[model samples]
Target chain A: MKKWKRSARLVDMTQQLLREPHRLIPLSDFAERYQAAKSSISEDLAIVHEVFQQEGSGFVETVSGAAGGVRYIPRAGWERSRETALRLCRELENPSRILPGGYLFLSDLLGDVSLVREIGLIWASFFHDREVDAVVTVETKGIPLAYATASYLGVPVVIIRRDSRITEGSVVTINTVSGSSKRLGSLSLSRRSLQEGARVLVIDDFMKAGGTVRGMIDLMSEFRAEVVGVGVMAETLTEERLVEESASLATVTDIDVKQNRIAVQLGSLFR
Target chain B: MKKWKRSARLVDMTQQLLREPHRLIPLSDFAERYQAAKSSISEDLAIVHEVFQQEGSGFVETVSGAAGGVRYIPRAGWERSRETALRLCRELENPSRILPGGYLFLSDLLGDVSLVREIGLIWASFFHDREVDAVVTVETKGIPLAYATASYLGVPVVIIRRDSRITEGSVVTINTVSGSSKRLGSLSLSRRSLQEGARVLVIDDFMKAGGTVRGMIDLMSEFRAEVVGVGVMAETLTEERLVEESASLATVTDIDVKQNRIAVQLGSLFR
Candidate 1:
């Protein structure tokens, strides 16, 4: 095998580490690939780690001993997380987003891939130490955010369907009622979607009194899975809350259809 | 600003380029960030580009002019694409995946983030040159694949709902009938989700006779959006095909639920 120059190796190594976040790659494997010594590889990793720390993007964690290797854990620093929350607040303040029934038009924001990815990074960083086995969310609006967070955390995303389909095989279904509107609904998850006793992080686009999220938590129990964390892109200020604890990126203080006004603030993630 | 060593600069630059796949970044911006000269930045880019090309991961295109900059275009090499498809085929062949009425249990596969991402990369590389303004997919199963492809292409995703929700505001809906089963359905897209005359790439998880994809193409016309391309993770062999042009990663030739047997082949993408 041909040896690689330090410059080329550094570029390739960064790409590999970033591509598979949270996956440990043995140093010997890298040493073999680059035809370089293990010490040289360690030096290269130190440089990458320092740059990542300086940039606040993420850090490369090193493990020692025979089964040791390095893994990239993605993170959004305090400055970046605050900036994202402020931007989301500004976007939510748009009067045109108020609908006929005071519902905010969020399809545009959810569809913005870059913005969704940024929000996902924040959640992944917030829950990085939870040892989450998977990211879970209900269908429709929450799918993108769930997938984004899962991608960054290097985990699979299991979506809960509003109505179970034939293609899902067997599923665990649960009943739910909207906390704010008192509407009835059901959430379903395929039996094979998650393993028993797996640790999961629940993610959603919007939360109002946490009815849907509460339902998700109940359903997770049916499979014997543990709920490690719950995060939402945005939440409304409601007097009655079903979920005891959760994190959100932005808060909707008020929405007035007749006045065409909406009030927004940074969410609990910043706090 | 302090000057950055070449090794550190290469690692950071790679991370930035890979994070935003198609966004062009000016050389001057790199120079300013690294406290280096434009010529040195150019040299660094060349090194990154060479490693990417050698690995068959992607290439960096440098646009030279007053407004010109460099952009990274991600691609999946033939060997890697083939490997992904074969692995998918093997996973699909398991008899446990067969459900009643011959419907395969695909929820597990769809929930696998790494597998879904690889499929997305294959589709993104296949349709990278189409100038896709957005990725469009129906709700539920297709959302993950659509989001993954959009993330790689650096484009937003517009989801077509089975039933229009009030939260969507004004929507354009169309009726659809399953080509294989002849089941009646409807597809809806938010009026503000897509712009008029925008180019879109359609992605889906499964296609038996392309009814869902066909409906999406028709619905895109309602907004005067052009369907630049259509791609699916898997498509079953059928005599009556509704779509004229499409790409797929894997093909199911036959399925015998009673006998618990499924015949699979490489999809049209390889051909």
Candidate 2:
């Protein structure tokens, strides 16, 4: 193949490989399909894999054994991750993010880029070693941080939609209460979204009463999936609903939105 | 340096480069800091750049001029992107996402993995060439979709808080009438969060009257940032007043909650 066509084919192959990541493809298959030598196909895969890793968008794992091939792992890189779940406890020392009636201003920080990046990077850094296949989160706010973590980890993100639809093909639905609005809401996951035995990292923008976390825990249980870890952008020390298995970037002690005065204790996230 | 340490250092350097992607860096500087040869540093950077591009996260540009170095350009890759976007438009045609007052039932799709992935990929494809630095959206539902697109493009996401906070450091506030509620509400962006001249991709879950999008547009202008593109999970085509340069995956014609029926039209994106 000529150079430009070869380059175009490389783009097509990269796209196809990314479409079905983590799935095995034999070198012989590529050689026959593209009418190219196995060595040339290998070179093309290397170029695509190198570009992806450099961007921190995904990972390429090549198996050298008899039945081995390249597998794409979508990763949420460090800069985009919320890595310091413990440090969040320190940031929670601040009187702010704590609102009257146990509400938290965490939605504010979750909306912040630098703060969420630090938090996401810290959380992803810890999960880098675990065989986490995907990151999951409830609808609305958690989606942002979840997407960030998923990108860094090079894994696809699965969001549990609050409403059901026929177009999803088939789904498992559950009723649960969210901590933020203190309202009962339904969560649904498509039957095909997650594979059984897949290790999942649960993340959220904030945890007040932990009701939503419990709901997610229940949701994951329905799929028979293991929850490897849980990370939050910020958590309230006031309620201990969530266990040590979960981590947070910032912690909130108090918030008096009525008085418009808030206090935040510095966390050890940057350190 | 040893292999593991060298990999860790490369990861650190990649993170640092991502933080200031617009700035170019010389291989000599990285080599000197790491006490490595220029050739080794170049090899490391090649790996980094490859990873970034393959994942559709970002890019590394080699400047051959007198004052040139490697620069990272955040861009999205087109693996399953067009297919995903087209699928989302088909799914949006489902009547389920429709709600009363011409509202669309997008909250569910925003939470779905396949749906979110397709939506994100589509949005990223549109802004891939615009050099979007951040994704912006209003509070609540829009956060998830915004995060997804931002993740694919490897850009930081800045969320506009519905409520203001002192801990946000300092914020620039704006007021606009939302098409949904039609009530005047205030949206705020932290001064430090957004940079001037940065191209932003605006994403939202649904658009009813275009009030919130207008508010977001006003908020972006307040920061002197550019609106590279706008995307929505669903749009109420019956409602006038769309934010001029916006796009939507699905269009809602009607929502009859009482009759248990919704009317929808698909494929309004890229228009």
Candidate 3:
């Protein structure tokens, strides 16, 4: 049997096992189907489990007793992952998305967790291969998506509030030029919220000029944390110097509010 | 064996199965442990699966093979159901929850899905013994909770937007007063969103004057949709007009914006 064919079969088997977890399969079954030895099948299962877990999806537990086989107890499923990113791209493409006073229309996207979950999965997928310790997003709108992504990654989400809240405890404050309107705004993170040397994944609902992203970068610098990657549900592609490396679920290229029609370009997502 | 003892054992086994979804067990093992016949075990399993599914909590899928056993998938565990209502009460208990205009500060609860999911589940539990075809909420805050509740019941969520959007196609508009402000607000729903004779679960993030709930009732009357129940994350308990029958996660007794504190009482939610 060809090596690529074996890998393809492995992928197929992995997906099947994921959908229906905890069922034990006899070794003879796979040996007959793949024309592989019991040892070979076991090796393939190990690889499949590793890839899935590394992707932050979940675990494939193997039971070794006579009744035991391999099962995928997914903490998160591929259905949730792929759908989340695709929906973000779709909503970001909307044209009325452009707001006066340099605000962006994200209430629709933030309101939809199905959309946020997919976007979170896509972002997590990008960093699935990368090492990241935590996710950060500004409070209010971005909290839902950030929380969704962190939940998928099995990490805690830290919100950067616009103002100090009694619940958040003490905080560190930073001032940065607004990427959208180019005005000054204060950004905040609770003290003890982030740990030192942690690789932080920054996420938000929208990025106009990347000012908020830049503010997060500054905050990370203040905490001595590492910026692993940046992700946004929607971004104005026209902006510059805001993000060194980033992913946008959708790109808003044109907005004609007078016509109440928005033009959007759907980018690569959810595949 | 006594009937009550057997029922208690069934509940325990049901919970255990729900906690571990992928692990299959043979009926003979359970039958031997309980000193009961296979027929009795089968009957118990049927009732267990039925109640679990009806609660919208999780499920039990049975395998018919000789070696096969029942598996529990803790998809949405009971802890999630209880914690949600508890958390909402905690947030609502804050004195700062009171607004000067007799409004309750429910924006925080509306944006959180975990909390919303719990609130939705509590609502679903009440309607579990009842029937609901859809969930209705006025845009934009109520939409998220409505979606969460609808997801729990496996029903559709119909949004009554303050302003009609062309994307939703033709809509039926009705003018009604908001509860807190006692000010009039328009509720509009797409004509295709709901069907006549459908029973609806009305959900909102906060309630003050009971006007929005009344407005929703009026809108339901227009479509001949039955108001199966009205639920709010928080409410001003002082309101006189009860809006017929309703449930609230939390109740606001007073607000001292001067002290930046709000006082609220927990309502009988899941009860």
Candidate 4:
């Protein structure tokens, strides 16, 4: 084994930690890999830790125990997250985005990799302390955001399909209503997508009156899974909220279809 | 400004590169951030570059000129990719995964973040030289894989919905057949999801005779977009493949319903 310098160790350690988020990597393993002392490895981690905190990239959590070591927790600072939400609000406020029935044409943002990742990092920060066994979301628009967040959290994503397919084996289907259109819809999930008694974090691209979010929460009960937290990239702001206790990066204050105007406000995160 | 040591600089650089893949990052930016000389930053990048290459993590390319800078290309080495595929093959060989009509129950692997990301990195490496403006995939299972690949490639994802919705505005719908079951199916893509003359890379979770892949390619033509390449996680072994010049990680050779056996083989990457 080669005795790596501090510079080389820092570079390798950062990559390792980022690749395996929420995983506890022992200092002894790093020491052995680089042929450095545990104390020296700790020093290298400290420098990486400081830069992560200062830059609002994430956190380096150190645990002192026989089986414990250092773990990387993906998160962004409060101000950084707020700025990300604000920038999104500006783009979503486009007049052309107003569609029928108060819906916004922001499909582009749901597919945007960088924007989804920014929201994912921010969402991860909020649930860094909670034990999230898996990330769950409905299919189509929300899959990208769910995958992005799951990647940062180093967890699997369970997508709720709109229709059941024979290829999915046995599935649990639930009937729910679309919040925006007030029409009934169905969501199905394969039995194997999640484990029994799993702690799930529900993520969706949009929350229009929270009907879809409520559907997801209700569906989790069928698997005996608990919905620990719910996060959405953007949600509608109104008095008639279907489900409460949710976080969003941006809020759709109003959408005037005939006037072709849409107002997007920074979400509850700013408050 | 406080000058950063070699260890601190390495950590910051790794994080910055990881955050913005395929984007050019000048050494001067790093030098200014750490208040270090350009020469020192170059030396640090060289060390980071060597580690990334050796570990099969990614690539660090350096260009020389007024606008030249280092760009990180997300990829995994051939050996690593092959190993990932082989491991997946072994697990997929389970007889229980066999479904009716030759379909395998692989929704689980499609949702696994680590697995999807590992395959996504490999797929991105295959088309890194191509001018990919966006990733295209059909709705449901392929969404996660498309998003993962798009994240690494730094491109947006355009999901083709099974059914058209008014919320998506004007959409282009195409009729296709299920490759295995020979049943008619419809796929629709929003007119605004992709721009005309754009180059697209198509990704999917499973492929059988490539009917769905063919549908996506035909739909892309409706948008005047070119399909640069196609990559699937697993493909069925049939001499009558509808689309050629594609890549896959694993191949299902045989699935015996009565015998309760499945034969999984390494895909084109091995060949």
Best by TM-score: 1
> For model 2, what is the alpha-carbon lDDT of residue A101?
59
Please give the distance, in angstroms, between residue B122's alpha carbon in candidate 1 and its true position after superposition.
Answer: 1.4
Winner on TM-score (1 vs 3): 1
Candidate 3 lDDT by residue in tens digits, B84-136: 66676677666654544434445445544346555665676666545777778
By DockQ, is 2 or 4 better?
A: 4
Q: How close is candidate 2 to the true structure, as a TM-score?
A: 0.61
Evaluate model 2: give its lDDT. 0.66
For model 3 the local lDDT of residue A191 reads 61
Ordered list by DockQ, greatest first: 1, 4, 2, 3
Error of 2 at A192 (Å): 11
Scored by TM against the true chain B, the candidates give 0.98, 0.69, 0.69, 0.96
TM-score of chain A of each: 0.98, 0.62, 0.68, 0.96
i-RMSD of all predictions = 0.9, 7.9, 12.3, 1.2
lDDT of 3: 0.64
Every candidate's lDDT: 0.92, 0.66, 0.64, 0.86
* Candidate 4: tens digits of C-alpha lDDT, residues B207-240: 8789999999999888999999999988878877
Better of 1 and 3 by DockQ: 1
| Cα lDDT of model 2 by residue, B1-271, tens digit | 3332344445545655655545677766677667787677677767667666755655677776667677666554555454565566666656554443534444445555446655666687676788788889876667767766765566777878776754355679987776655678799877777889889989988776788888898889889999888887777754467478778766766667677665656646544
What's the CA error at residue A149 for candidate 2, in Å? 3.2
Give the per-residue lDDT of model 3 (tens digit) for A157-207: 666767554434456899889765677878887566778888989988777
Best by lDDT: 1
lDDT of 2 at B132: 83
